[model samples]
Target: MHTLKRVRLAIFLGILPSLVIYLGIAVLPIAISFYYSFLNWDGFSPAVFVGLDNFIEIVKDIVFWSAVKNNIIMMGASLIFQIPLGLLLALLLNRPLKGIKIFRTIGFFPVVISSVIVSLTWGMLYNTEYGFINGILSAVGLDAWQHNWLGDPNWAMVSLCITYIWQNCGFFMVIFLSALQGVSNEVIEAAEMDGATGLKRVLFVTLPMIRDTLWVTVIFSISNSFRVFDLIYVMTAGGPAHNTEVMTIYMYNNSFTSLRFGYGSAVSIFILAFSLIVIYVANKFTNKDN
Candidate 1:
């Protein structure tokens, strides 16, 4: 008991500083934000209590709904594009081969780069006239395909989705690669002995082993989608007339641009609640025994 007590005391001492910092930066702000959500304030003017009014307005706002739709699209795109591509590339590169380390480094390079840089780079590539993408289209005698990539309402969100995939798939690739390396060689050999090879090996032998990792990545991808602001903000600022607005951008515009602190706080609370519920649901699905 004394030894255990000593260990506990050491652990407490070790964690106390970090715990305090976490509470100060994360927990306290969230609590304050929740309290502020129930009021009317222009961020500077005196706050007035207005119970449920902000939430009610959020539910009715057409722009809020639009932002929600965009967020869903981003989540879907991440799952459909990034995760699968990551898994596929991880599979391809998991083999013992020459220059594999180089390939891995290249795969993870973009993830280390700042998101702002990625957005700005994509912004240039999407420019109407001199952008490489449009230049290639025009060169191929498809001038009709060349337009203002970020300005087109129909394609702006699509452009953002593609940029997101390019920048993030590498991170997931590294994750899935590490998880793949952890899979048991005995199980793999057993699958091969049972005539499972290629796609069959991957489907029945490999994916099942890393199911938990996949779910964790999915949850991460979904949560990241909810919080995505910088890329879209840099690329479109949630425009061509709010075509690319997402939840984070909506909250940002309300809190900063419009200076509606109370309403923005309410939006932030909604973001928190929605993310928690989604993550909870995803956790349920991640249970391997089920």
Candidate 2:
């Protein structure tokens, strides 16, 4: 019993610093935000109590609804684009080619790059003047299609989706690739021997084997969709009449730009609750699927 107690004490010591940081940075801020959400204050001023007013305003705000719609669009796009493309790339790279390592490295290159740099790179490419996309369109005599990619309301969300897919697909690719490596070669060979090949083998044998990983990736994609702010902020600043605005950016504008820190805190709480509900539903679905 004494030895067991000593082992537990050592384990506690090992995790103590991490626990402290997590509580201080994450838990404390969330607790404070919950308290502040009921008040009315600029960040520096004395907070005045106004229970549920911030949340009430959120429900009535048209722009907030628009931002929620954008978030749903982003989530759908990420699900449709990121994981599927990643799985495709992972499957292709899983083959034993002459330069497989190089291909794998290239496939994962975007994920390692800073999000700011990725946003800037895509922003320049999507620029109206001196942008690669419009230049290509004009050079190919498709001038009618060339418009301000990020400035037009119709295209801003689409542009952001494409940029998001380009920037983050590699992450899921690497994830699926790692999971793919753990799949049994004997099982694969058995499927191959049983007349399974190409897409059939992938759809039937491989995908089922990595189903759990895919579910995890889906959850990651959903959570990442909610947290996406830096890239959109850098590229569009939720502009084009707020067509590309998402919850995080909306919250940021309320807190910092409009100086309604209390309302922003309420928005933050909403984001947290929304994310938790999504994750819960996803978990239930995945459990049922498994």
Candidate 3:
């Protein structure tokens, strides 16, 4: 009993710091933001209680809706591109080839690199006149295919999506790779003996073994899509008429740029609500599928 009590006390001590930090940084700020959402205040002025005004204003703003649309686009692109690409890369790297470790490192390099640097590098690559992409098109006698990649509204969101995919696919790749590595070699050999080879083996044996990891990556991708800010902010500042604006950027603009503390808090609340609702629906769908 004494030893068990000591172990339980140690476990609680180990978790207490993290719990406190989470409450301080995440829960506390969210509570404060919820409180502020009901007020009318410019950072400096005395707050006046104006319940639901901020939310009503947000509902009426077309820009907020546009931001929501862009966010959905980002989420869709991440789901469609990042997860599949990552899984493909992981499958390719899960072999016993020579120099496989080198290849794995190369595949995961982008994930470890700074996001700001990745955004800037991609921004240069997407430049209108002298960018690598347009230059390639011009060299191939396809100048007609080239346009202002980042400057044009038609292509700005597309450009951001491409950049976003490049920056984060490596992260999911590493995750999937770990899950694939954990898959039992005995199971794979058994599948092979049963005449399952290549694609058939991967589909029937490998993928099912790592099903939980795949779901985790899906949930993470959904949450990360909502949290994307610094990359898009640096790349376009949600520019070209806010074509690439997301909820986070919208919240930042309202809270800091426009100095509407209450309005921004209201926006934050909406962001939280939207994130929770979408995640909950996704969870329900996934559970039903399972």
Candidate 4:
């Protein structure tokens, strides 16, 4: 009985700090946001309770919809390009070749760098006048392809997506590499022996074995894709004609720039809800497969 009491006390003491920190850092703000979502507060004056008005305004806001659409595009682009490229890179590096460790390190270097640095680098690279990309295009007699990539609304989002893929693919490649290592070699060898080759082997054996890891990677990639802000902000500042506005950017502009705290909170709540739904649906299928 004394041992049980001491054990309980030790457990309580260990968890007490975590509970306080969680409430202070995570739970408290979420609660405040939920409370503020129903009120009109400019961050300077008293909050006025305007229940559901913010939500109604959000529904009617064209810019909000545009931001949402842009996020969806970002998410789709990441799904289509980032993970597949990461997987391919991981597969290539998984083999034992001369200086392969150096290649793997190079692939992961971008992820360790700050997003601001990556964005600035890419921004300069996309510069129309004397940027490396345009310089190369002009040098190669493809001057027509050299335009203001970041300034053009049609290309701004695409350009940002490319930068995002370049920045994060390394991290996902590491994740896939770890997961790929866990794949049973004997299973792969047996499949190979049964006449499965190349794409067929990957589809029939490797993919199914790594299904859980793929689902996890996809969920995280989707979340990160949807939450993109720094690259877009540094590169386009939501851009020439608001062509690259995402939900978080919209929220930031409303909360900080426009001083519409209540409205921003409402937008945040919408984003949170949407993201939760997406992750939930994804997990439903993923967990079911378990």
Best by lDDT: 2
**Cα lDDT of model 3 by residue, 3-37, tens digit:** 99999999999999999999999999999999999
User: How would you encode candidate 4's per-residue C-alpha lDDT over 1-290 as one tens digit per residue?
Assistant: 99999999999999999999999998899888989999999988998999999999999999889999999999998889999999999988988799999999999999999999999999999998878999999999998887899999889889989999999999889999998899988988999999998889888888888888899898998789778889899988898778899999999999999999999999989989989989898889889945
Clashes of 3: 0
Q: What ranges in model 3 sit over 4 Å off? A: 1-7
Residue-level lDDT of model 1, residues 56-108, one tens digit each, is 99999999999999999999999999999999889989999999999999988
lDDT of 2 by residue, 116-181 (tens): 999999999998999999999999999999989999999999999998998889999999999999
Which pairs of residues collide in model 1? none
Error of 1 at 264 (Å): 0.8
Q: What count of clashes does model 1 give?
A: 0
Global fold similarity of model 3 (TM-score):
0.96
TM-score of 2: 0.97
10 residues in a row with least lDDT, candidate 3: 281-290
**Candidate 2's error at 237, in angstroms?**
0.5
- What candidate 1 gets wrong by more than 4 Å, as runs, is 288-290
Q: How many residue pairs clash in all the candidates, one count each?
A: 0, 0, 0, 0
Q: Rank the candidates by TM-score, best first.
A: 2, 1, 3, 4
C-alpha root-mean-square deviation, each candidate:
1.3, 1.2, 1.5, 1.8
On lDDT, who's better, 1 or 2?
Answer: 2
Off by over 4 Å in 2: none
Instruction: Return the TM-score for candidate 1, rounded to 2 decimals.
Output: 0.96
